[model samples]
Target: MISLSLPSPAPPSFKPPNPNPKPHKPKTLKPSSSNPLHNRPIHHLDQAQLNKAISTLDLMSHHNSAADLLTYSLLLKSCIRFRNFELGKLLHKKLTNSGLELDSVLLNSLITLYSKSGDPVTASLVFEEMGERKRDLVSWSSLISCYANNDMEFEAIVKFIDMIELGFCPNEYSFCAVIKACSVKENVWIGKIILGFVIKSGFFDTDVCVGCALIDMFVNGGCDLESAKKVFDKMPERNAVTWTLMITRYMQMGQASDALELFLDMVVGGNAPDQFTFSGVISACAKLGMLSLGKQLHSQVIRLGLVSDVCVGCSLIDMYAKCMVDGTMVDSRRVFDGMSEHNVMSWTAIITGYVGTGGCDKEAIELFSEMICGQTIPNHFTFSAVLKACTNLSDLCLGEQVYTHAVKLGLASVNCVGNSLVSMYARCGWMENARKAFDILFEKNLVSYNAIVDGYAKNLDSDEAFKLYGQIEDTGFEVDIFTFASLLSGAASIGAIGVGTSKQLFKCLMK
Candidate 1:
């Protein structure tokens, strides 16, 4: 028993005796022989150790002695570092009651603690309490960052402008926060205006972080991609995040070739691509069906020891499946099997690859079963893929069972799952059940109509097939090659190809 003077712990909702309580004199204590923590520096302790120290302080009575502002500030820093919101709130209550003055440093720490805890309201309260004279650059910057992180973009931007109006020079962190706010608000005008300030501040060329934020502002605000590229190209220094953003944006814009080219440039620049970059570039390889280049990237993936990442594993599976060499899916399976664990995305990717690759229906179904037995919940895409396997194998019983499982999971009415259900039932000669599934769909797409029309045509139901064909235009979907093929096949089977049918067929051929 060693006892240190400190405020006794109180509930989060406890109010102090008054707004400005009289300060208590703090008496320094020497190391106690009984408590090991008495000798240890508070700032050097990890979060768990700091928590134990706080617990020891909490047991002391308010009348025993009081901790100085520095000790309280150090405890607040630990709370923010560990994101221990409860402890921080308790400490806040104690600090307010301890009669220690709240300085700029402690107030900034409170703002950050509340901000990181997703309590922007409390952070705002703390900022307001700092008063105009005591608020420093760090206080304003922390508050702006708090608003930006909590989706209060408008407030962040306002605070930023206020900071500038108050004769405070905006720093790199300040510009990044405001720019992110503008990006989220989609206020391209404000974002461009801020870009000029960024140029004036000289952070655009020197600070990689500020440049990345500008690029993100332009790209995500739906502004011109050219502007984003111009900013990216002009940046004197770029980090891995910078390269990854450009690569990802290129892939999204369907410029896979440009993305791949940029990736080579990135490698040449000596900035090693992270797992995210690898995933994007590998997907670009899949999109272009570049088997040889994909293999090279795969080698890099293995060398960098990123082969076990779920995202990388999924991309590799997709790339191998799409860029198949000799029409075999051995590589995809190898990657999937090599992963240490499987998440929903990884399982879905492998199953989708199997379903897309021909003659692997049984393997896809088995994998689906394994996924289910492993207690991994399957999403709508998983159900859609497994149901397609049932359609390919014409296993009506298995399809019905899977359908039951989907219904139990409350995903039966999802568009993708419903479309697959219709296709599965119709292909297995269950037209009534297929129509039932089709009618239950919450939102029908062109694919759903195509599946039902093709099923009727294949089953020799020319009347229903023609009826559905006439309604395609009414549903705002253009008739495609699949629609024409189904109609022609139906007419040919029933000897119903008349002048009108011939004219339509000719029109389809012309298109």
Candidate 2:
């Protein structure tokens, strides 16, 4: 016994157990279907997991009623989240057939799904069905918001009025929707009424959304700068949107100095200008023809990493084009060539810049041709600019080609494009062609008629020109001073002045 004890003590001092140990059996994670913990739907899952769950659910046989309503609702929500309209519709039909349509949460989810699907018709139908049952503010707001977001502002405003008539006091979201609709309409009177309601309802002081919308309403309502300033001044807090809207208001009013002052105020107030802010200020500079200010803003834009922004870059080009100094076209071309991504506005800006600087007609024509060859669809403004270039270059051939293009594109009827085409042909001494264009126009405005008449007069076709002047008078158009002057000059050149024509010319001069 003594020897055994001595050996045990010596062994304990000299040896350690085996360094490597066997891993415990991973407790054979029980099958999810069998384990209560695993059977429950995962909570706080990320977007990916939720998506995966939706896919898995979709893979399951449609006959599986074992999938609860909550699971279906969650899948529908995920479909909305991912904007998978087809899957959303499928889930929605299933939920409806399952008699869960009356479920307030499920119904709300369906409304949201339809809204996100861009099928506002279906959303409206669902909303109507909800009205036949128990309804809540969420239901009303969802339908109203869908209408507003989809640019059915008139419908949304009407619905808001209906909602109020139904005795439902609008929440902040409802007010925001109504205000946004008013803003879209540019109805300052309606906006003021809405603002009063917002204030009397005490929503403006508490809700940032209402405040923001109020600001937008004033600014977009044709430079209600005073009201905009009032809203801005009264707000206890202002975000980037508020500041941007104020800056934009000034810019839109052609008040560049005011815009710059506001920009400086924003800086002093510690609000960093975003791309929109910079774009607005740059536009103000463009309107004012302030190249120096535009350049300074451009430098700030580079520092703010917004130089590449399409809108800001376009504004910068426009600003340079509007400068009184020489080399504006060079600066505009430089900006245009430097752009990495080109959209219609990018090309349009450069073309407009060329048009602004006299005798860039060739460059403008080349750019328009390039744009067409690149398969970029030209808009009405594009056609107008190209026609102007044709006029400047006296390229009757090019003008006819552009006219054909405009007719094919169904843009020939647009007043501005039509006017430009008439002027183009007139300037090129193509009076007959100008007359043809005028006749084809659906409705001739004073400008179009005047352009054709002026063209004939300039070409010394006094007979044709006088006939057009009589036609203009017969069409209930009051000839302006320019028209009278043109007619007088044509009569003087052809020695065909009549007493009637002389009296009309005198009256026009008096006018």
Candidate 3:
């Protein structure tokens, strides 16, 4: 949603003298002499420099002159790099008004600009405006990627088919985009058909990117992990991205051990792991509670100069927190402190670690406040962690404030946040608030029932607790040990029950 304000293009006009025009020069503007602007350092320009460049264009228009294709292309590059749609729109207006004929290269850039800006209809119009001679492979590929990246999977697939029927040879980029579309639509059949085409076209042998796309296709289209592994095992070459992809998929499937083993293989194969690779492996260490292994990996991260990466830093923080030795969060805090930047994930990890460590609830709450003050919005996990801290400190006042924040964000009805709110209110001896939070939950699980029932039982409201127990039975929920323990506690508080009542309770428990 980046926006830039510039003057609208006017019809051809003569130059007019400005009495007090400010002197402005764009700094470090080093566009190369041959085919300058489009491929140069215009992307590095700040707002003021970009304004100066546009002002130069304004001066051109004042002289009834149109900027050449190179100038327009460079400005378009700057606009795309900054995601400034308005500036691009202005460029389009000027380009249209100019008598210059659109070349395929400039048209391709326009297609890409519109596509990446999430305006596929305009992209389609631009594509349609091109003659058959002007529609090159890059033009087709850009359109396919636009559709695939913007959730138009069906259109992407159809366009791939159309491109093939039109006698255009599909390249690696084309295969990757179409395969991604198939993956999104769960069209494994079409993906495998494309795999055959890939092999026949020799892209599978020459381009590792095509192979990687196939692996992702099979993995995301509900195929087994072994299918993805088969593609991985047969690749002619593997880059850090390819290795990281497999490792990450393994982690997503809950096979952390398998992911770790693959990382070892990746290293042994002389492949260098990137920040994402290190992050995935460190997460494996965290899951297995391998503190020593995690520390070794941390050393590797520091050596590789990736310790400053936000993702790697977050993963290290989480690993050290989960692998706390002697109940000390010193390692986790040290990692958090050393991080150059903090995103919501990093902030949540540190706050959660402090909450899980004993006697650090106040510290956790303070960190949460700091996160808010830094303009980092808290997610459901963040709210849950701070609410747990509130419960531990018996700070109902702070808990209520946190709940208000969650409500404002509309996360109060989210399952994890709602469950945490109920637990916090119940523990704080506010059954009414607890019940209100419970009722608004979009869906409830056993934990929700247990929290309210336990609250009533502990408060010696045996009648309400028993009624909730009946409702639980009517709903066909299998009563767990917690329910039995709470009901027994309630019964004991009201003195011994008669034989018939005891028999009925035992019967329900057996069921």
| Cα RMSDs, all models | 12.8, 15.2, 11.6
Model 2, 415-444: lDDT tens per residue? 879999889878887777787878888878
Pick by TM-score: 1 or 3, better one: 3
TM-scores, each model vs. reference: 0.68, 0.73, 0.75
Q: Write the per-residue lDDT of candidate 3 for residues 245-271, one digit (tens) a residue.
A: 999988888899899889888877777
| Candidate 1 whole-model C-alpha lDDT, 0 to 1 | 0.84
Model 1 CA deviation exceeding 4 Å by range: 1-44, 47-54, 60-100, 326-328, 341-345, 358-511
Candidate 1 residue pairs that clash:
5-65
| Between candidates 2 and 3, the lDDT winner | 3
- Candidate 2: clashing pairs of residues: none
Give the number of the best model, judged by lDDT: 1
Clashing residue pair totals per candidate (backbone < 3 A): 1, 0, 0
408-451 per-residue lDDT for model 1 (tens digits): 99998899999999999889888998888888789988899999
Model 3: lDDT of residue 82: 79
Alpha carbon lDDT of residue 178, candidate 2? 77
Model 3 misplacement above 4 A = 1-48, 97-100, 131-133, 377-381, 391-397, 403-511
Residue pairs in collision within model 3:
none
